[model samples]
Target chain A: MAHAADRRCVVIKADVHLAREGFTMDVQFQAEGSVLGVFGPSGAGKTTLINLIAGLEKPHRGSMALDQQTLFDAAQQIDVRTHQRRIGVVFQEHRLFPHYSVTGNLLYGARRENGDLDRVVTLLELSPLLDRRINQLSGGERQRIALGRALLSRPQLLLLDEPLASLDLRLRRQIIPYLRRVRDELRVPIVYVSHDLTEILQLTDQLLVLERGKSVGCGRYGEIVHTDAVLSVVHDRGMNNVLVARVLEHKAEDGVSVLEIGPREQGEPTGRLFAPLCAAEVGATVSISIRPWDIALAAAPVSGVSILNQVRGTVLRCTGHERRMLVDVNIGAPLIVEISRRSATTLHIEPGTPIVCLIKSHSVQFVGALGPGSPQ
Target chain B: MTPEEWSALLLSLRVALWSMAIMLVPGIACAALLARKKFPGKVILDAAIHLPLVLPPVVVGYVLLLSLGRHGWLGGWLYNSLGVEVAFTWKAAAIASAVMGFPLLVRAVRLAMELVDPRLEQAARTLGASPWRVFATITLPLALPGVLTGMVLAFARSLGEFGATITFAGNIEGATRTLPTAIYTYTQVPGGDGPAMRLMVISIALSFAALIASELCSRWLTRRIGAAL
Candidate 1:
């Protein structure tokens, strides 16, 4: 996670206000991360916000800057054209050119002197698809090519408008690894927009939540998820806590794998949790996601239970929703556990209160396996 | 066929090809404009481009004569300034056929251009391609089948051009007499039905071959682009 600090520079600053026939979008936010996930529901002007950033749509007023370069300024009457903006976009539909082969499409926007084509093709595993026609590619293959095409353009910024939305659940999981590779390998900053919070969380914890064309919250996922505005939108969608963990060992006879969660400091409060056996080698880092409601909060450890994990942690904050309460617990890494309001009252869960978090071995799902070079 | 018939057939092919070449670029330009642009007088411009499709071919020829005839405004300027003669010449025959066939070319190409997905062009722009580059690399190639169809239609129209060629360029046997005009000339004399029928058969065969060639080309192009036009 130390590499994440290098990408903390502000990538985009947009304060734009637009009003079309039936919808109006007035949002102001600054994106700073290797990947800033834009999360919102349908008709929340998510696409419009990206369009304005990509220069595909004009804002009636306000200004935008990318990497501290002025992209659009209404008071200055400066609006850079889309092509001159040098921002590559991967639309939801792939939008590949029907006339060009895979190689041609990739090279259509490549900067020849840089010679990054081979790197991009190799990174995305596109060598075999080079000669194939666009229509001949599968949904996953087409998305890979689209991503490669945008990467080869040498863009200062990348805009992904639901790049995986068109794919099925399995296909989306397949593409997420490639996207992670791009984020780690490429220097280009990315602005990924999707309505699925789980999908966004898998990429980066920093999110810009949009509700009805307005910014509800913008910050770390753990810090903002408990807010009323973000909760209402993400509650029904099933919010999950995404964490990076390192494989400690595997108990093959016991049919469970042990993983060390959170930072690797000498005196850190990292906890070892049991998960289902996975193919990842020991010492490799993997991303795991667990639903909030899957974990039960207990006042103290129980010995006679069948649960595989009962890690002790201190509660940070608790927010009561309509029927459920979201308890933020710092068990090495921050985890949001959803429990009944009655449970909170019985357990006396509040800031600085010690508690035990109950979990099952199969509750943790392996979302993705990071490459060897990526730090945990 | 006699030398007279051979000359007529060759001249008709030459005129038809020249007509297609003359109209190809402008026809595509007009089609792209009509398909992708909006401005004042768009409806009027569209109607004017399609005038030949609905109006009599003789009237179109007469209008060309009025503007580009030897003593006419544009023709006189060309004659005086550049010492160029355009009336009753082979070039005039090509122009006459091109004018008559222009509407078909524009209509087919416009339909094709209209069918091109605008999102692809937007993607290209975001990929750092200029607007013109987007048109050349994405829009035009996707609409290629329609363009081929339009060219074939214009070529066939030029081959069968009679009234416009007759009215503007006159029926000069070696210079301006295309297939239909030659057929008309042969039918005028007594006992000339044999040559007239021969020329008529050649006209039908030429049109048929052009159509079949167009269909094959469009299919191949559509397959190359991997989509139905």
Candidate 2:
């Protein structure tokens, strides 16, 4: 019973110390999951953490271990060579060999003894792209091939460093499903490093938040975002409230998709949020992101309001900085509502006060097609 | 052309080809090391590789003679242990050419190696390739155009070699007498204008052909590697 946690997953214990270009990186964290997201802003040692894990770069002094394997132990002078580490990496630039065809690039690192080449090729939908030259593939296609190639390498752990950062919004959406499939079907343990909070949440709930070469926090997105200091850093990026919901009904005439926030039994009417017409099956779960500015607080239910989503909740707290005020309303999930000081004072919004929160269906962005694990 | 002239042309081609062949692997190895690696004697090694480019060709030839001649250190070892004689022979001419051309070969390949993004090599490393395999598959193929350019440059330099070849090989007729050495012989002798002029035209034609061939080959290689994104 004492070792029950050790058997379920691989434990990545990283205590890395590296210095480059006047920036010294001394960050440490333990990640245990199928997909651990490394969250950080630009130049915050996000990629550095990934590089050290993949053995692309060595730490000046530290020890790294994965699932009982000693990767780098500076004290013992034990550094596993990159090739021998069996850790696959998909760089942000998607570094596919230009001289090779799609299939050649995919098979570059594939293991002859035990590599699932055809399965990955099919999983990432790479059959039509096998014979094409790398130059001919689009940005999304290149990333798919890169993902397939890394998976074909038969790595014990896959490190993806902002695999969709270089892509546009459309391309990012296109690649998110492939990432979900990698996690769900293949069930390979992955370390996904990204600066985008929403994108990170799309793939996994567990995260290691980094700031300026230091790990500020590491936990579920719902838990780590509550810290006052962590909230301030994330606030600078206009962070939004996210809720895991499942699609219930898609009405084309209304141009809205009804999504339930919790498990919808036969008669248990759970909270339902509506978003614009989304390409989701009737029972599929999705992560919806609502910007704080789009949420409106009301003292009572009012008609003639064009907004579709109205949830009853209590005001947790209200705080203001500069010209914006953040009103935390507990609507099943913590939803931050941005409002002017005039309205906060006029409505007399305070902690423990019952309120009705209204948000337009159009404002609710369906950001991610999460697997069945979502929709609590 | 007379048989003597024909022989000079053929001997020059042979020496140049031999020189390029001798430096190919070592040239790329030196270039890869100089461009990608940081070692204790890096700057010193770089300066030594480029010594022939800066110092006089005759000085390089003298050094080669002292170190590689029959009675010289390495030359003595080679002759005594391996029964291979290299002083004042066509092999000596080729050695002289390789030495003078060494700087050019390394410079071109080094520049190409530098242009290759180290990230690509790192990507290959993370994809389960050994360091040597990464160099062979990613680094070598990407730098192919530059490698080809360096080889052609070294071959051209060897073909036109005069000071180093004459100083070390002694210009033996029908053996070490390459095109440039033969041209020098004609120019020095009285009433040698006919042979010298004929050889001059032939030398220009051959040099141009070599240049055109090198250009085409490098362009083809670049096309095969595809343009950098």
Candidate 3:
């Protein structure tokens, strides 16, 4: 048996053409360990990218590989069939086999090899529903089974095409944590496709932005979210900064946790960000996502403020949009703060201005812990 | 009823039952081939399978007679090598009925095959089931209702066959005589109405029974498969 560390990367290089409903997709990219979120509008070929990787559709011209194992190479005349590729696919609609019991579907892939089955059932919280028929399962339950089914395949990589896209917001919220859990515990690389920005940001670190069947951008979400080009595509709505933070102290009595933000390279920016105290224990690593619009910048560090987070940084760049001004500040790393254009002109904020970035600590949403062996 | 009427009734039942049974395997084979597999000349094969449905029954009977009659080339070889002479025999009448009933069976089976979800078979394939195994376990079980419907339809069609039966296997008492042929014989004779009416009633009952049986079997099998409407 090989450990997770021994596995290879998934490299997809394709220039595929599919004509449908007056839209065409000509995409190509590759990823490894990091969850590569394919983000785009409907019919932009985000799902098509996953389909090509899953072997559900063939490319017109391309070479795809995983850890040097050639999956598809037009020049080499090699195309491995879907079933033999040792990859698991979770489709948009939960594609659970209606004829089989939950256990049957979960074991469908596992049975192809001789391995322990009980462990998978327990890990996925599927023990109770094992004997239940798929037709009897709720939509949420069906997706859980679909996830478990894909996991049990012991795939080298997994491809999920908007697994939660069909569910209601509450259901999507309910499944996000499970996805994060899977990503943290399992070493397999995942290629997830979704238009939901929050869901993708909450679950994945790496992202591949797609538009009109072309790859527009690819990188860590936190690093790319601040770029003017990426923000222009993201439309700079509620999307903001994703910071790698640690719980320096948790004051349960005050119902707040002090998160250490800004890299040690910048001598820690001299202030703390207040966040939800319930999500973590003291000294645990967590991800804090704060929308750019929620952050307020002032020229002076004011006293008697109700806002719990006040960080001092120098503005690196500023770009004015129709109703808002996007300011990039380098505290330790670049953070994009979206402010009203009126305020930017009134405060006279510009590049190289020393200012205090103020945000209500409660705006921080804490995501899951950094996985073991994760590079901080 | 006269002895002739009784023999004809028995002969019709025998020929229809034997004809349905004989056509079943080939009918399913043809339907499966048409439904699941793609090949060169597929359109031609489909048209050929359905020829009996479109052509006049007399034409099909004439074609059969030309190919299988005792003096025909294939017919002569069978007679000389195996001492098999099908012309004017009850077996020849059964063959004619089977050919006429074939398209009905194939149509029913093919429709059923189409109704089954292809994804189920693909799931089976991913589960490590071979193509043949997938067909047996997933395809055949799901398609059972259609197969049963086809079988009943073929049996009913064979029970009522007249033109093809007479054309290929000439009416002869206790040999090639069937219900329709006997009815013809009685109509041609003097004061034969009583026997013909009784046999006609029996024929009607048999046909009705076959239709009812098909309905019940389709319901039962559909329920057994637990298929959602």
Candidate 4:
């Protein structure tokens, strides 16, 4: 659908065919003014998708449009050159012009914005080190400058292809907040290419999980993060569940969340589920991640313990590996618990063991989801 | 040294400078083509570029003379269209020197272009720079050191070119004679040994200067790029 003479931000809509070094990808999706993450391993066409979006590579038989502009349409015989496409791209290495100072590299993109210099500089927070040479900056600082340069272009859309991959873990952590600020404050939509689930969780609302050059799953993180397809790749050797639980009340004395888990099934009682450090209000819903390892099994109702979660349930299955065991407990629903083989033998855990599972309230992590009422 | 030696040394410098200036563009263009693009007959093009390096200097000179002489095909067209005679002239001497030095220039430039990371160009493209803009703003600047090295090597080669210049441009004094031709002429004349020895010393100095200039240019370029980012 093409809109004429309208100022809606560019919406990426394309099916692309890219084949190189024995890998072939044919991906199609529509993205608007939200962070859409192309998540996959290296060589899974995540960066290729980004390059295609930025017009760095052409698709052989696909049609792509950004905003109302026709970028490429093999049938229509239209391919707007990269410079004319008004798309900003940042690479993993930053790729700052080696011949320019930090200011000059930033202005290289800023000057292309047609006189919106002040706005971009303000938005990306690039005022302090404007005069510094790019090579003189630290890895995190260089990435920030690179981000500022991309933003200065005032592009309809931005594509980031693993901008933090080259950084050490500490530097990566330092730059992540700035990435969020860009998403929050700027009007530009970003197509972030990353294989890191942590980045996907923190920075993006929408996701396209790629495997072998194909989109195996695509949805908001809430919808797909726990799905069989997403989980198969994400939790290959582990079992974790992200539950949309409401913080019913906080026991500050013990630092735990009395979370209301699951939906009201018309007749079922809404019981309190204990989570680690309740950070939300009494009625505020937060997606809490429960790792299987944080749960413990007890054959009886053990008292006089700091472990606040003592849920009564029947053991569905007990599977043991060389060092660890996966115990499936049906606490109204199936909850997976991971324990060491020593603990399994010590507790004498087995299938159909009517047991109480204990979870320390501080072990639950609060992570939100992209629901219908999510911020735009 | 003597007036004759000074004249020959000055003539060599002039011939090399002019020849280098003439071939710089073509050499860079060829190098860029070889580095960036591939097509049918690419191997053949590569071989053709290296022909001057493989061929004997005298054979190269004879080929130049056959094609650029007064009655030859290109020479006839030049004479008929522009009344310009190239063979047996200083211009022919410069052309011969450039031919001898062309391989050196092309090889240096091609190596430099190859070393330039192609990812930088792709980054430029994503920044909304056109192909030509990327070449001008990114590729050309990054490859300047290599181009300078090529130019110096070519100039040095041109300064010492003897067989090609003598065969194509002849040994006329102050007209077609360059340093190498003058040296050739002096060796033939009796009692010209002193002048010939002085010219040989001048040739060595000039080659050393060219090398130093190339080294300085490369270091400066490296520093400039390193300081910027």
Question: What would the per-residue lDDT of candidate 1 be over residues A1-376, giving only the tens digit for each residue?
Answer: 4366555345678899999999999899887778999998899999998899889999999999987799999999999999999889999999988887788899999987888988998888899999887887888888899999999998888889999999988677777767777777775678899988778887888899898888888888888889888888887775888887889998998998999887565358477899998778898888888898999988889889999989888999999988889999989888999999999999888999999999898999887766633332
Q: Point to the candidate with the largest DockQ.
A: 1
Q: For candidate 4, lDDT tens digit of each residue in B1-229?
A: 7666666677777888899989989988889889899988988988888888888888988998889987889988998999999998888888998988888898988998887888878877767778888888888888889889999989989988988888888888877777777777788889889787878787888899889988997999989885654
Q: Which candidate is the best by lDDT?
A: 1
Model 3 residue B11 CA deviation (Å) reads 5.9
Give candidate 2 misplaced runs (Cα > 4 Å): A1-8, A252-255, A262-271, A279-285, A292-307, A312-359, A369-376
- In model 1, the clashing pairs are none
> Candidates 2 and 3: which is better by TM-score?
2
Q: Model 4, range A1-376, lDDT digits (tens) per residue? A: 1111122334667777776778888887776546787787777788778777777788888888876778899889898888877788889888888887777777775554266556656655667777777777877778788888888777778888899899987566556656665665665677888877656655655778887787767876544544555656655522354455666776778766588665444334435678766445667655566778888888898989988778888887776664667777777655778788998898888878888878887777665532312311
**TM-score on alpha carbons, each prediction:** 0.95, 0.88, 0.79, 0.79
Clashes of each: 0, 0, 0, 5
lDDT of 2 by residue, A85-179 (tens): 99989889989888887888988998887658889977887888888888888888898999998898888888899999889987887788778
Q: Model 4 scores what on Cα lDDT?
A: 0.75
Better of 2 and 4 by TM-score: 2
Give the top-scoring candidate (TM-score).
1
Place model 3 in a CAPRI quality band: acceptable
Model 2 lDDT, residue A239, Cα: 72
Q: What is the descending DockQ order?
A: 1, 2, 4, 3
The residue-by-residue lDDT of candidate 3 on A89-184, one tens digit each, is 777877665555677678777755556467666556677788776666778778888888888878777788899888986576567656665665
What is the Cα-based lDDT of residue B12 in candidate 1? Answer: 89
DockQ of candidate 2, scored on C-alphas against the true complex (2 decimals):
0.60
Give the runs in model 3 whose Cα sits over 4 Å from its true position: A1-9, A184-186, A226-229, A236-288, A298-301, A311-336, A339-356, A365-376, B1-43, B73-94, B117-143, B170-202, B220-229
The native-contact fraction of candidate 3 is: 0.08
Q: Give the Cα lDDT of each candidate.
A: 0.88, 0.84, 0.77, 0.75
Clashing pairs in 4: A10-A67, A135-B229, A275-A361, A276-A361, A276-A362
